[model samples]
Target: MSANRYPLEVDVAIVGSGPTSAAYARILSELAPEARIAMFEVGPSISNPPGAHVKNIGDPAARAAAQRASEGPGAGAATVNSPGEVKAGTRQARPGTFLLTEGYAADGEDGLPVAAMSSNVGGMGAHWTGACPRPGGAERIGFLDDLDALLAEAERLLGVTTQAFEQAPLPQKVRELLAAQVDQDRVAEYRVQPMPLAVHRRPEGQLVWSGADVVMGEATRNNENFTLFDNSLVRRVLTDGAAASGVELSDQLTGQQYQVAARCVVVGADALRTPQLLWASGIRPEALGRYLNDQAQVVFASRLRGVEASQGAGAPGAGLSEQSGVSWVPYTDEEPFHGQIMQLDASPVPLADDDPVVPGSIVGLGLFCAKDLSAQDRVEFDDQVPDFYGMPSMRIHYRLSEADHQVIERAKQQIVRLGHAVGDPLDERPFVMPPGSSLHYQGTTRMGTADDGTSVCSPDSEVWQVPGLFVAGNGVIPTATACNPTLTSVALAVRGARRIAEKLNNSLLMSKSDNRMSE
Candidate 1:
């Protein structure tokens, strides 16, 4: 857990230090107090003295991930130059596919693969809108009872906060909009709770922020057991056949590599990278890189007349006032991905795709996320598209099915209805409309009854083929729920940690009893 020293051995080795990994580490510490656990992160650890990316808003890690995406199949292609040269950025524009690092996604008519989003450190959680919603009955009917318990466990580990937002003022436009909807019974059954956030909330003046640095950050520096390795990129999982024994990693800064062992291994490296790591390690199942799904997101921007100025897009210090809920109801559809609608309060700052006409304004962003029903969407590893470190990048294959289109239409109609209730005319067109805009990647490695079909892990998240290997995060979701996968992933990781602890305890007891009998 020290910056200067690398841990030689650990009871558990967690590949990612994101929300899921964080939850697993915390649970392991509580359940097995004396068990030595080491959490490895490819990025620089979050310190009291924050990096330039977190402090100055430069976000180097994000830049690297973006670069990796850009160099892949569709988004990054070579173009013929005037002076008899081939260029990297001069080809036909393609919407990057969002998928995993190990599987081959089917190409379009032109035979080019799609690109998916990837990140280091807190991963996607760093750029998330922070809206947490649980899956409905329609989404969970197929799984076992342990899923219900795991979902409950997830809520507890996330410090699910519903009453915390009462102290802050509700945005005037949001309040008016919700009031009108309630009066019309359009949202009669649903209740908006405080958005569940992983970070701790601090009182005003209690913590001082000088630019991007939060001096008294307890989440990162205060925990003695919490060890974070920043700027370290994981290359592959080290294993023998299906059994995972250790992890092979490379330092993003120095390009140094090492192999670290663990009693149990948990992978939380997002939907894309998790599979890639598994594949590189030669741990393959028919389901390893298949069934990749992401929440279809459509972004809408509107200028409000009376709302106060927003700090920026995904502003770290900006206060979230009166968090709202994602209202969803189950409607049985032939589609594989569930349909749900979520309302998010986004800052007016320029995002990745901002309209030229209204680049800067009081923008209220609305994102409608749905699931992908088709199995055609997938991921593949390309040796051609390489990063600075020469590690292969994932070629993501993603496209919206008819189900996604219908769900988007429904969400648009709902938005219009809400506008009419508030005595405001709805805008006819959105700023950027896409099939799978919301980046909630999930369901690549699903949990199932056995190893032959429909699963990479069992009901308890144990790798079906390997005893010590475990899968976590959105990558292992059995079904793509309509809600954000972060909460669900964290919950699954916690449940997995508990199961590991139980197995370990039983094994130790049996060994001790055998020794006593022999004596």
Candidate 2:
């Protein structure tokens, strides 16, 4: 069958094939196996047969090249075509197989090195480092009810666990050494502990990172009622009064437009695009694209002087072993910074015949400071200038606050002290990465207890004024949390999917009752 000939109607339509959307699909498939569902993705599907990228994980350069090839010329530049095509020779690929479009940010914001995101089928989850940590009680947003239960379910769905390091003792050693040197009260407040990762460790001691595709691949393949359309960019949600009826989609490659009707619609197109799509569709709530937040990070790297590096560094097995050594200093109610320390493998060196290989190891630390969600930090759309998908061009607005700078200073001091304690002082002071570099953008479509002008979604993740419309992803998180938001976002998506499933089941039951009464 032609790709264009897909079913024009489905029980539910989801936009963006990211982790949040995949999680929603997984849950809905289990809860309502017969529910007809369709997922729309702006980027092309993974290369046929999958696993090509997984195989290249050990070769950073090759992986980067593949990502650049996939991203095309538009990977880092702005485009006005229907589907942004990658330009030739634009190959500063990051450490993944997916490439992100450049120049989406407005003029002033263009200088900021925002964390590049994947536009492919799996979204950022495809390129993520799999760091999964639960937000502390202080980081939880008050507006979201039953946060504990939601998190518990999310952890289960994502396979969040600390088992990966059960055999790796490096983290424990580092934690103990740090604890001994630091004040007991300060150590308790910092809550230093082993970092929890969203990965499954096999019986053979191999780790299987949980990507969106890994999470939903089997379910999508097994469920005949489910369909996925890639390279299909959704331009807008079609609304009937306050309720959504479907969406208008454009094929990124062919520039063809079509409409699909649905009983419910969900938008999980990341933080930036979710609001952009809503605004383009004229469903602009007062706070539709406001209160954007991202974790501002201070990165520090140090080489272990007087130590020899392992011979087989940069290999996949070594990388996994290094990952097992990862540890974290979580933020507390008293302190607003969360820290992580990990061992870095050796870089690829050009070896000479006579040169002896004195391999050395490096340790890197990242101090992430929480930024308060602010209305001024937002995403705006320019309707006059259409992008590759014929949607409004986006502009990102963000600025660091004075308080944020203070936290950075504190983080730097902490890193310096820790470095000295370990006798691996950093070559230089901590470097503060540009805003948005963390890839933790959130709060553009925040959820709140009430549908006030400040929030976009209700507690159930439904659009406040738009019935039958729901949103899932990091953008729905109402708070500025220092920890990675993937697990939390997936959890919220599960919660939202539950609500939508209930609504659809109820509608189906009522329709049957009405039919019987009429007969």
lDDT top scorer:
2
Model 2 lDDT, residue 494, Cα: 80
Worst 10 residues of 2 by lDDT: 346-355
TM-score of 2: 0.86
Q: What lDDT tens digits, residue by residue, belong to model 1 across residues 219-242?
A: 434546546666666688777665
lDDT per residue for candidate 2 within 186-292, as digits (tens), equals 64535667677766654665555556765575666688888888878899999998899999988777877899999899999888889989999999998988998
Which parts of model 2 are misplaced by more than 4 Å?
1-3, 47-66, 69-73, 76-111, 181-183, 186-190, 201-205, 304-314, 317-319, 322-324, 345-360, 515-519
Error of 2 at 197 (Å): 0.6
Each model's TM-score? 0.73, 0.86
Best by TM-score: 2
Candidate 1 RMSD to the correct structure: 7.4
